[model samples]
Target chain A: MENLAIQLENVSKSFKYFQLKNVDLTLPTGQIMGFVGANGAGKSTTIRILMGLMQADSGVVKVLGHSQPENQTLVKKEVGFSSEEMKLYGAKNLAWHIDFIKSIYPQWNQAYANELLKRFDLNLEQKIKQFSKGQQIKAQLLLVLARKPKLLVLDEPTTGLDPVARHEVMAELALILRDEDRTVLFSSHNTADVEKISDQITFIDRGRILDSNDKESFFENWKKIQVELPSETLLFRHHRSIGIEQAGKLASVTTNAFTPEILTDMQKQNIKVLAVEKMSLEEIFIANVSYRRQGE
Target chain B: MNLRLNPSMIYKLTTKDFLLFRPFLVVYILICALAAGVMIAPIEGAYYLGVILVITVSIGSGIHFALTSVIIEKKENQMSFIMGLPINATDYAVSKTVGGMVVYFLNWLPMLVITLSLIYFSHLPNGLIPISILCFLQILTGVVVVLCIGVGTGSEGFTIVMVVIFNILFNLFLSVVGQLPGISEFIQGNEAVFNATFFSVFGIEILALILVLSLTLFIKSRNACFL
Candidate 1:
């Protein structure tokens, strides 16, 4: 319990149009958990609940070993949160923000902040309003990173960045996780970044978490099988398949519940397996969301 | 768990707002100074000009601070930034209310003192001094209401409507208080008089101020969503 940076149990919240139901999550220290969800899929809502910016209608949220919102002040002293909805004071310069945050957090590191300034190429003297979107995002990240927090929760941190800027941000995140005691839980629909860095990943759609697992096991569990049909009348029939993209005689089947039996089942159908490929994080997320929506 | 208030955090938050509203504070102070000069001047009808200027400074600064520092924080999405800090909504509400009132009075007190001094030194009835003090309380009450509304609603349009109503109602209050028997008697007579009616008016203003602050805190503490 002490090793976990964040823990959510049976947490629920409902709005007029959406609801997050019984979201149970646990991210231990020294790991990054990527929260993937579509637009308005309750990703930000869940993050807000954890930060104590919003209260859950039911259940518990614990961050940094303290009950959230109840101990939010204590929790916040150790957790650094950044989200797209959170804006920097436009009238103030980076220097002012640094000073302001430094005054609040005792763990602030001037040396690391300076290093980030050089790395991100952010001018501390320039007002935040003068920064470009990517620069602003980088500046926000720099401020949070320099705090040397025990836990970092970022919501869509790379949503609007160009590819280069995205790379820079991802690289900086990787650098932060070098400290074995630090943990991060970031939400993004951009699975590429999530795939590259997250040790654990959670998929949310509408208002529920569809799946949560370690990156390697999560990837290993999803398989994309391409099979060639004998006559095109029927491709391959398997109970485990969640999605199928067919093009003429070649049928691609995606499955979340992959096993050795799938190959035997395809062989029994006289279907020639063309290739068995691993699904990317994005592919798995799409297939997973598609499967859940279909079930609903 | 016991709820604890961090005084240092509150002070820092208050100081942050003070710095943020520094430019507006400077403008209000200058206006106040000009109003003070007008009150002491010997020009014809200078008293009326001074009163009008004082009212303008009082209400205008209230509206300006409530809009710029209070409402604009929500409009610009800076509430999330502030709430993202190591403070809760309670702390934020307390800071805004305290900081705004402090800055408001920084300009208001001096103007009140100077204007009352001018009245005292001049041929105006001593009773007008108490009336003037009551009027200042009315202005404080209005400003407090505006701040409370701004913090509680976090809506510019709603707070603006309330401020408009406060200004109109303040004028009505002044008219009604002016016509009170005790006040009218003091104005007609040249002596300073402590009257029940005048104290009742003062009590209402104090009560309103307290109620607004308490309501702001109540609304803020129950807020489930900051952004």
Candidate 2:
């Protein structure tokens, strides 16, 4: 197995109204893991725990082979973090932040920082407070990326950016993925962005991890099958599958285990298949959250 | 693994802090100049020094409290950035403490020079060296204790409370000591009290430094939740 850059074993955190229970996650070296969750699905909370910013109530969190809260300083050195909520000095210009970070991290890539600065169309002289939301996001990215950390943990890096800025940020991240040794774990509610760049995707809902797999395997396993059930029969009720919805005699089935045998089995049950459609990451996310919410 | 405190990194942080404190520097200089004017206007030497000391300490505490609590942390979102940095949190905390101390020293330097000039011009009977040494030790001890409180409580109001209480207690303790009839007689009879007290204060100052350093390291190691 490739060396895992991040590992969370049976991690759990609890609050009065919300609880993250038994969240197990693993991001091997050199893979971009997109964490998909709803607004209050505990995405940022998990990321914060992983970054050693917040401690998990119970569970083992190891990043870069260092135990968290104890070895956070060592782990932080090799990890680059950027988030929507993290802001730089408002009065200080970009150059000042650049110089400041550069002074700390000896591995800072000056050329890469300059390249990103040019690409993001951010002037070093511009005060961070005066920059637009998009520009600020780009500037934040610039600061983190230049550190050339082994792992990058980003929380909603493109949440408030316009389409063009989002595309710019996504494209830059894509270029970073070209390096086979760098690992990225980013959380986003925007499934399109996740779909575009993630090698692995994990869906979280109501503080529980609903599904996690490689993007290819996840796509391969889940299918939205539209079927017409016989008027007198309930076909989905007898099926052993992950999710199924019946509206009158018409049934829509989503299976975690999708194969040629499933189709044949459905046919044997006298269900006439109307269409078998591939589900996008967004559809999978919504279906997962909604299904769990409905207590399915 | 890269855990050394690079001088360049400290320098950068210091410079950044200095720049952020530019406006305060101007105000501090003005205050120091005003204090110097008071000291040099042929006033009684001890009274002028006492007034200048009170004013300097009050202003220094206020500025330090404000800078550490409201301005610096608010401006950089420094808690997050500093937490994310590769350096140990203890080092980061120490950097802030040292940075504040440097600023505090800068604020006092002008006043010290002015007081020395006053002594030289007036030819006061008091020895300038002992007074200067006492002032230095007092200020040094005050800065460390105040900065530790600032960093530990992570609030300006807390620092203010601590400083006020400390000043009150210190004044009371001094009053009590001075009232002991034999204490003054012994001090006046022997020249060793001045040196002993100065050295004792210096030793306590060092102890305070060690205590604050250890506490800061503990705080950093705890990895308390921060935005």
TM-score on alpha carbons, each prediction: 0.92, 0.81
In angstroms, how far off is B140's CA in candidate 1?
Answer: 1.3
Report the C-alpha lDDT of model 1 over A1-296, residue by residue, as the tens digit: 35888899999999999999999999998888999998998899999999988889999898877987777787888888898877888988999889988998888999989988998889999999999888888898888989988889999998878898888888877776654556899899899989877989999999998999999997777999989988767554467888888888889999888888888888887889989999899989998998899999
In order, what DockQ does each candidate have?
0.61, 0.38
Q: Per-residue alpha-carbon lDDT of model 1 for B1-227, expressed as tens digits?
A: 22255677888877777777777777787787788578667888986888889888877877787787688888787777777788777777777886678867776787788777767777666778878889888988888788888988777888989988998998898899889988877874666677898899899899989888877777776654454
Predicted structure 2, TM vs. truth: 0.81
Give Cα distance to truth, residue A4, candidate 1, Å.
1.6
**Scoring model 1 with DockQ, what do you get?**
0.61
Most accurate candidate by DockQ: 1
| Model 1 bad stretches (over 4 Å) | A162-164, A178-181, A259-261, B1-3, B117-127, B185-198, B222-227
